[model samples]
Target: MRRDAWWVPQIGAFVVLSSFLAYATWAAFQNAHYEFGSYLSPFYSPLITGDSPHAWFRTRPWFVPAISPALLILPFPAGFRFTCYYYRGTYYKAFWADPPGCAVGEPRNSYLGEKSFPLILQNVHRYFMYAAVLFLGILALDAYRGYWFAGPDGVKHFGIGVGSLVLTINVCLLSGYTLGCHSLRHLVGGYLDRLSGRPLRRKAYDCVSCLNRGHMNWAWFSLFWVAFSDIYVRMCSMGIWHDVRIL
Candidate 1:
């Protein structure tokens, strides 16, 4: 019989998550404005096949449907977040209301405990973790690319732009979140019996632990920055905003 505002955060989470999904889904389908200058939307990074000069592959094959390149790549990163342990708890409470919060009443009494068909799929989270790590590298490269802009004479010059800062911060936040993952932390030292002999492993484990401590903060910040980074690039591409050079 708790009378506190326990349900407040759940409602907040629902609204924030729903909005992100709606915007992300719409942006992925647009296909245009995901790339501007050297800045690339994380959703379309490693742009496998598209019109952007940063595309990792040649133009889309003639036989393939004219879908957005993002549709082809978003799944990997999306799967990572979908199966993330923290996100699992967050969404389960906000979306499913499975005991929504401490002392909260759940809708059903039966518990499957992640052993059945749907919940069992969460076991693939570690694999998705691998993909997330790889994306961090790709995004970091994109951030680096954001710093250079083509001058009027067709020459690229190194300079700081708002997009560059946005991209750099996005990758940094993502890195903190990804690197501190429970899977990555386990990978670092979970198998070892002792840290006495492995100095490097111990050091790595300590680093991961530090980030994991603030995992929730990292998750929220990175999520917001990622969507914002895309908006910045998209607006610059559409001429709604200019990529101002800071330096």
Candidate 2:
């Protein structure tokens, strides 16, 4: 039977996710502190200066050394998986609270089914898996960039600037999403002859399934939030808004 045709909620979600991603992509390229005279950077406030929360980025001629380029690369896999039919069948239906009328595109078959041209791009998940793993390592390095410098008082200080924090959380979220990948889950589960009397393999399968449950939501949320986090840091570095630290 054909899958139900629903389009409204799906379209709404697409719109919201698209808007957030569009603004964030532009923000990711900017300095951490961007400011306007009359108004602060949009959605940020308090105008922090000095070294209370973290050190600021020096306005440089070229790209800043500490910024993670994954800010740019991570979006590719996100866009891919968001449109994947597998996610539409499983995660989007449950967690996204997608209504019956919001099916932007209906699935034609199972994950192993045939693909035609653009639809075949779903296979690109394998390519994205490689990129996601490599970028995770890169983001870890970017997080460590905080440790490269110290405070003037000779204190062992690694500035957890807005950029640093965002990079850290972004990596964590990416890890969660990546772990949820069906390919990775299978890798962890292994291709065994049988599961009979195998406790460890069963345990691993259970763990992977847990992560897989929210895979789609995490994919989209992490993708969008990572970009937004970069924007928050960039605006801070540009001297446009304050990334206020409560602690």
Candidate 3:
């Protein structure tokens, strides 16, 4: 194990990142003013101030209007399992890498270094990558629903609430983060060896290569921001903070 006194920064990063993630997870479980039913019809608006029977609550059940808990926690383990630095022996050197702390006398076998289950979770990153991307589409749908016309004033409006902005920003951050992934970039654009002489191949490869260079930073930053987005909405719902509406 490479021993250096640089563990402070690693530990600090882990603590700050984990704290934000935990808060976001907590917020995701809280109920916000989500208009799941109104989204079914673009012309639906509950704040119309008339007895139009189009009130949103009639169609929307009060069940959890957010994602399943399993999907919420998926990012934590999935992120830890596939972190490029961890498998490459960075964890042992930086105590902060392993939140559980390093195990003494841990054998660093190149093949099965950390054994079965945890290692198996590493493969899940590929699958979760698809899931994360799909969630972006959902966010986009939510953003579209955020737009509405004020019935009382008969004025055109495209107002955004806390939840809608959160959803939109979450998707944007995730897209940037996902596109900057090293493994994903390789999977999508690294097949250039098979098309070496193709005119557009080299250009594609160059683009992915540039993204790959900043992949690590983007991955972590995006992971944190998405969680923060959910927290922002949750806080707004809890009356802890106001979710600013943008027109």
Candidate 4:
């Protein structure tokens, strides 16, 4: 009813996040040109089915030639985000208008916590964190591959390119978001009643706690950077732009 500063950010987040979801969904189904030279789009990382010996899986249903390889793997990361604690608060307000913001009137008078059919699924966030960690490892490997390139002389050389740095930054930001997850923090040492006696676990808990303090910031940063990394690689693969060599 009343205009406020919070509404501006809510609307902005809704627009940006919706646009990204649309683009990512479209890009995932294309299943073409996800890799260019040393750069690989984050959206298509861990390429399951492709024309490479290193491919771990290949889809050959013959019924769907246009089926994208990423279609099979995107659900893991998508699930993690969909049920993320930070994201729950985000979309709950932005999209669902669950009391949109402080002092704002809610559309529903009766609030049903995540106990019903669909919302009860939110309880699976911890399990999704496990898969998210695995994906971080896979993406980190992709970033490492970005630093290696073959020369015209049929020799491999280690070098850095603009795409390499972009992918590296994307992985780092994602790692921050994943490692800082509340579930991870609880896993680290939340069960221990006396953390004072365990030095190693205490240190680990402190580290994760530090990151958790900035969880929201990491969430948005990683979200945008991953999308940017994918776009950068896509453009390079299409020959629309060239990756600048840094080394």
Collision pairs in model 4: none
Query: What value of lDDT does candidate 1 attain over all alpha carbons?
Result: 0.88
Global lDDT scores for all candidate models: 0.88, 0.54, 0.49, 0.86
lDDT of 3 by residue, 1-247 (tens): 5465445656765665567656545543432332232121111112222223334243335452434333444454346434543222434344423332344333343444346876555555556566555555555565566555355677646676555655566557666666555556666667445756665766666776786677656666665665565445445545777655565
Pick out the ten consecutive residues of candidate 2 with the lowest summed lDDT.
37-46
Candidate 2 or 4, higher TM-score?
Answer: 4
Candidates' RMSD to native: 1.5, 8.6, 7.4, 2.4
Candidate 1 residue lDDT tens string, 1-247: 7899999989988998899889989999998889888899988887877556798657676665677878877888788888888888998999988868889888888888688988999999999999899999999999999998899998989999999999999999999999989999999996778988899999999999899989988988998999999999999999999888898
The best candidate in terms of lDDT: 1
**Candidate 3 — worst ten consecutive residues by lDDT sum?**
37-46
* Candidates 2 and 3 compared by TM-score, better number: 3
Clashing residue pairs found in predicted model 1: none
The candidate that wins on TM-score is 1
Q: Can you tell me which runs of candidate 3 are displaced by over 4 Å?
A: 1-5, 28-111, 114-117, 147-156, 160-167, 197-204
